[model samples]
Target: MCGTEEEMREVAGRICRNYLHGAWKTVEPQALGFRRISRVARRSVLRSNSFTMDEPKKVLLRIYGQVHGERAMDAIVTESVIFTLLSERRLGPKLHGVFSGGRIEQYIPELSEPALSMKIAEKMAAIHSMDVPLSKEPTWLWKTMGKWTRTVREERLSENIHGKSVDFEKEVEWLKKFIATVESPVAFCHNDMQE
Candidate 1:
């Protein structure tokens, strides 16, 4: 379920109450210019309003089952990867805090054209510099991809396609094989980065 304005305000208030308790402050909820998925709390840039905070301060909060377990895991992994990159000064944004709920990060608001490009380049460089240790353990990428592909195929199959057939399994297998052949040095990856 999507959170209403009241719910969002409540969440923000709770964040302030729990983390910034007794600190000098005012809590004002401003609409952010982003589309957020309530399920995973994923935000994507879209045409919306912008909220200005007094300052971008970090706060920590708990993550309940409301957010998917896999999303939680992904957040943890992303935080760790970004932390290593930022410590080396290879990324633009600095991490403010990592809490049970999620991570808070800060970025310099003002940037010239050249500086922005430089920052992007630095982020890429950091990712390329990571050393990904080899593991005998199973990787989830293939399984996750397979599931995604299967879902797509099932959706297509359900659509009435007269006198037409698709080899869903074969296609999925080919894609899996192609993915397995790709090998690259591990680097810090944002996986998700946008305004």
Candidate 2:
């Protein structure tokens, strides 16, 4: 099933209440994709016969999509570890809580002005400089690409270049051969950098 807003709110509320401090008031869906984002706020109670309302301080609820149960667990664990490291280094958002499917993280505001290219490069350098406690084996890229290629072929999805069919399996084979020709160093990479 697609990730609905109601489902997102319910899950976010449950996560915030149990894992985070404060009385979580509401959860509003912000963005949705492979991962889901929601803004959660806390309730402020004021005394003295006054109908009081609190200013919303937002925190983000990030829910991971289900792929394969056991298979996905390792990836989640690795992500949690990496996020923790990055947050502590002030490179990524602060991690609030972790649940079965997802985690709560500090909400970062969108920048009104575009960052300088140098600043962006510095952040990327910092991320790459991190010595995360995960496997250094660079197998995930090829594995993921292979899996996607297989799925496409199995589903009989057509790809054409100039009205001629293209075989992804063969394409992958070609890439595998040509890829190693370029010397590339494996570093901690932000797989999802696009906003």
Best by TM-score: 2
The C-alpha lDDT values of all candidates are 0.49, 0.60
- Residue-wise C-alpha lDDT for candidate 1, range 98-194, written one tens digit per residue: 4465444443434447778777777667665655443434455666767766786778873445776667677768976886788853343446443
User: How high a TM-score does candidate 1 get?
Assistant: 0.55
> What TM-score does each of the candidates earn?
0.55, 0.67
Score candidate 1 by lDDT.
Answer: 0.49
- Could you tell me which 10 consecutive residues in candidate 2 have the lowest summed lDDT? 41-50
Encode model 2's per-residue lDDT on 1-195: one tens digit a residue. 135756644555555557654335332223222133322222111111112243224556565665584457887788778787877888876776777766666655562336745565688788887777777887887888788887888877746657888788888888888878989877777664422
Q: Which ranges in model 2 have alpha carbons more than 4 Å from their true place?
A: 1-11, 22-56, 115-121, 158-162
- How far does residue 14 in candidate 1 sit from its true spot (Å)? 3.3
